[model samples]
Target: MLTTEIREAFLPYCLPDITDEEVNEVVQSLKSGWLAKGPRTIEFEKKFAEYVGAEHAVAMNSCTAALHIALLSANIGPGDEVITTPMTFAASANTIIHVGAVPVFADIDPETGCIDPDEIAKKVTPRTKAIIPVHYSGHSCDLDAIYEIADKHGLFVSEDAAHAIYTRYKGRMIGDNPKGAVSYSFYATKNLSTGEGGMLVTNNEEIANRARVLITHGMSRNAWNRYAKGGSWKYDIEEPGYKYNMFDIQASLGLIQLDRLEEMQQRRAQIADRYNRAFSELAAVKVPTVSEGTTTHSWHLYVLRVNPAELRIDRDQLIEELKERNVGTSVHFIPVHLMTAYSKKFGYKKGDFPNAEAWFENIVSLPLYPSMTDDDVDYVISSVQDIVHKFGK
Candidate 1:
């Protein structure tokens, strides 16, 4: 074990970068007594839509809810199938099941861990109604190819952009397409921290309106409006819907977080660059790859691949070693097919998604958050190098 004369505390894998402005805004909301979905939520939605260059934005309690409502709005239900990558959070696929649709897994590009458009094309059947491309690790998937496939198949594109809040493809933001609805997350560790919140952005007015109603218990009018001055107490529920509305407290934090997003994103990019430079020459480590024409990446995670043959230790062992050195790390995902729930229910085997399984075997996500200082970054780099030198074949 390597020990330093001056010891540092264990560094967490990810941390939310919150400022006093967020705290103050939340406090103001608390004092206003308009706690539930109200003016602040509405303002956040409007500003988020404008920021993403979308026609409408609906704030929700979670990205899973946003995705579920997006599928519902698209009218994807029983006997329908949604194509998605296996190398993503379970919520991306689970949302399809929530809407009574089948989630068909597609193989990912081995280099990018994003759904391969070609694989998606092959997976389309008569029952396939939509393509849910997940922006894995904040890298924009091949949107042009996926969009082309969607057009040819006449399928909807509901993007699970949980990791791609600020990612862009061909100078256009991820959530700007009308044919596709994009869902974003403001989970505690997301680039933008709202504790637990999400937003759905789309250009179709009808879809937006349907989602708005569906997120608030299917009520025609919200409680804040009905109880406000000169407002009617009458309300109607046209359909059964989930309670997924974002509260003013969450929106208050989001409103300020949005203001700092650009700067935070820059810091993330700098950290990624530093990691790349430090690991580029190492034979055992494989740095992440970006598409040629993409303008900006949100860099939500800095995932590295370890060549088992070059390194005497396996990916899990590397993670264990990092922990021993007081550095935290994580795995982006375990392929859905490998999870007990999916495997047992769907009768899926380990070989079902070879690409996803292969990537999962070698991947580990390093610490890459905006809150990390320069010294923190250097320590991580040094720790990784030391491990490689000690363990490499």
Candidate 2:
């Protein structure tokens, strides 16, 4: 039982661990005069590719853009069906619709909240063109099973690695393999912070090359080269494309963030370990799991599942109680299928995905950013323990 008083200050669910290094890099990029898709962006791309052991990495304005362009480059449009999990942010499925494809929602594994390969197999059809598996909460989906299913159907797999910067699957990084395109987010709340930016990584030269062209309005060359000395004024629009290019300003932050990634990630891991140890003995709380020796979870979000049957209060009540105690909490998602946009378009309702719906009701993401102090971690843990004990049935 926790005896400490409720915290005096509020602790947000997540915060970017920015420092003087990130600020200095951004300032340097600003002073360089060439901000939009310049040298820093190029260097960021290279460093990011090397970090993930990917053959190529293309920087974009957002992870949504990365997914859209990745699907577009793979020729997934019109009559295609892209299979993904509903237990994710809207961007995962929205990108499928954006590329004129249908978003097929597969149920998730109740334990890990990842799309079940079995469900994915059942959803496959003649029109199925690709699979976009989100590394939900930085826990890598079962790559062996997902890839095996994709192989059997001859489908493309574009990974929504938005939450998985440091996640490893079967001893290899998510994007390290040549099987498909993997998109990573460097959003303000992501494991790797860049304010707002994303990267699309793949081993396929064709996909990488096409993605580059598609991000810059389908131009033959990027803006930096077009405006540089000895550059030709003439350019050609190869295809109608969107303005998804990431700027040097964002890349500057990304470079420094990438450099400090391991250090920050270690801090996140330490906090997660503390949470796991503290919560393990609580019957009403279920901590997130990892695959032991086979994979490395990035610990981006420390989501806890409340056993409603064992509690006097429900998940929503738990969140409210935590907030009342000055600890911020959030649901990783509301299950994309249940959202107004997807529900209306796909004709989905509450019971459509029972696992996701049930999981959605109980899961809560606690404050788990690298910037959090040990006291912050303790406050969150003690608060949760206190609430559960007070409300336990």
Candidate 3:
């Protein structure tokens, strides 16, 4: 049981580092009245493209929408198969189903929790139209191998980079290549948040133009421009598309967030370092690892793996103890295959993905956000140590 003092000073699992600048930007957007996908959205797209080293960017309402559009732009549809990891959020796999495509699950590298290139290679078939590699916890996947496989199979590569805004692979940005598109999330808890938004980045002009058209009801131009200067009201719907455009209001927040991204990322790295140093000596906990040649991890989620055999308590009990101590924590994800929707739909069994299932049983995401104070980090570390010492076998 946690003591009253610890409970009173417990830290939140994730906190958005919104500052006065973000608030002011939102206020300014409100006053401008051009709150839809207008100037701010365009500006954000340009800035984001530059930030990610992509040739083009299309802002949308959510990463899910961006991913859906990325697939659609690639002409992926019914009977098409997309390979992805089972260890990620369902959205990564669900986006494939959304487009009438089949999502084939690939096992992850147990160490990094990223889709194993070898597993992805084994799953490829004639119907495999695309491969979606998720950068789990902001750690770069084996892109070298994944891309080589894609090249050999002549398949498209669309990255589910929801956790990799600042991650890099071999000195290149995750989405820098136009051969495949990369989708980023700006959800409230993401590295670069616009409350709830996403962006699709690509170097191919054709895909970029098509994605822009598909995001706005398949119209020739966006609604923000239908009534703007030199823009006519008349338009034609080329293809039926979803309503997934980003509002300028969200872009307002994004602009400021981008400005402070480096500072925020630095803080997150510092916290990760502190946690790593404190937890490295504990045999009951396994800290995340970064591979050689990888640079700039976004530090999105600090997932700690507990050795159940070494500790008397289980992962759930650890979470419960953290809650009891008022130190909020969360699970990075429950593998998609484990969920009822995915299980019954796909006839997936518990042992379908041994690495992912095993990881799920022992993983816990600690409180890891840029806004955490030193004191907050200290509290979380102390609370974790207290639990481990008390419960370790």
lDDT of residue 233 for candidate 1? 87
Total clashing pairs for each candidate: 0, 0, 0
lDDT at position 197, candidate 3: 100
Error of 1 at 53 (Å): 0.4
Pairs of residues at least 3 apart in sequence or in different chains that clash in candidate 3: none
Q: How well is each residue in 1-393 modelled by candidate 2, as lDDT tens digits?
A: 557697788899988989999999889889999778889999999999999999999999999999999999998999899999999999999999999899999999999998989999999999999999989999999888998999999999999999999998888887886589999998999999888989999999999999999998888876567878877788799999889999989999999999999999899999999999999999999999776423788998889999877888999999999999999999988988888988788798889899999999999999999889999998888898899888898
Between candidates 2 and 3, name the one with more favorable TM-score: 2
Model 3 ranges off by over 4 Å: 1-4
Number of the top candidate by TM-score? 2
TM-score of each: 0.98, 0.98, 0.97
The sequence of per-residue lDDT tens digits that candidate 1 reaches over residues 1-393 is 443322369999999998899999999999998989889999999999999999999999999999999999999999999999999999999999899898899999998999999999999999999999999999999988999999998999999989998899888888875576999999998999899999999999989999988988898876557778878988899799889999999999999999999999999999999999999988989999988645788899999999888899999999998898888999999998687877777787899889999999999999999889998898888888888988888
Give residue 154's error in model 3 in angstroms.
0.9
What lDDT tens digits, residue by residue, belong to model 3 across residues 59-126?
99999999999999999999999999999999999999999998899999999999999999999999
